[model samples]
Target: MADYDLEALSLGELKKMQKDVAKAIATFEDRQKAEARAKVEAFARDLGYSLPELFGTETKSTRAPAAAKYRHPENPSLTWSGRGRKPQWFVEALAAGKTASDLAIS
Candidate 1:
């Protein structure tokens, strides 16, 4: 490992060095993760299971799409799963003094 006299470096040099260090760290982390994953997969195979069989593969739609947890008051078609970002209709309804419970599909 080469020693760096960071204190002696100019602002531009320091910035460049910082960028280089970040790239190196990212590469090192990626390599480490790949190695760890390989080891785990190998162990799983030895135990008579593939990696996905051991860890479980991510399904495109996990356990069926989340049922609509919230629905628009005027439009039943406009619904939300209450998972990700609030929909525009949901936000507008809130702004219009509608509580989340008021929009429940049930």
Candidate 2:
């Protein structure tokens, strides 16, 4: 990380620095998603929801729905399972252009 010359920074420069800081924070958040998924999965398991019963992405459908119901591959029981405070491998997979049907439920 480069040191910011705080004394030399103008208002515009400060705004640019703020934007850069925001970008860095967003990047760190993206990287932490895997850790978040693991935490959610563990919590879901403790709460008595079998992962497979919730996510149910194992079966392949020839005529899959254009927008199938999203589930967390990690916890699966989460209400907003796609992406949010909680993240899932299945959601990440779909984002990477792989269908949910391609991943085996474990």
Candidate 3:
């Protein structure tokens, strides 16, 4: 760790440094976990097995992007796939006497 003259730093500089230190502390565990996983994966590969093969869990995204099913009336560019939580505009549109069919893309 580098020595710092804490008294010389301005409030802004000190706050920024505090935020940096907090972020570093938070990500340190994640970096260590990734390193440990890498080491395990290397060892697994040498033993003719993968981590996923042993654990039966994939670390990759397999779901493809869903096509947009609904669009904003005023904003044609704004769209939703009709999955998950409804967007604010979509909710407001429903409250404004617009049916889901009205928002459905043709």
Global lDDT of each model? 0.90, 0.67, 0.96
TM-score of each: 0.53, 0.33, 0.52
Instruction: State how far residue 7 of model 3 sits from its true place (Å).
Output: 1.7
Q: What are the root-mean-square deviations of the candidates from the true structure over C-alphas?
A: 5.7, 19.9, 6.0
Residues 1-105, model 1: lDDT tens digits: 999898899999999989999999999999999999999988988999997786688566557788889988888888899999999999998999999998988
Q: Which stretches of candidate 1 lie over 4 Å from their true place?
A: 60-106
* Global CA lDDT computed for model 1: 0.90
Q: By lDDT, who's the top model here?
A: 3
lDDT tens readout by residue for model 2, 3-93: 8789898999899989999999999998799788788788888998765667886677795334334555556563342333434555576
By TM-score: ranked, best first: 1, 3, 2
- lDDT (C-alpha) at residue 62 in model 1: 50
lDDT of 3 by residue, 1-106 (tens): 8999999999999999999999999899899999999999999999999988999888676899899999999999999999999999999999999999999999
Q: Which residue segments of model 3 deviate by more than 4 Å?
A: 59-106
| TM-score between model 2 and native | 0.33
Better of 1 and 3 by TM-score: 1
Q: Which ten contiguous residues of candidate 3 have the minimum total lDDT?
A: 56-65
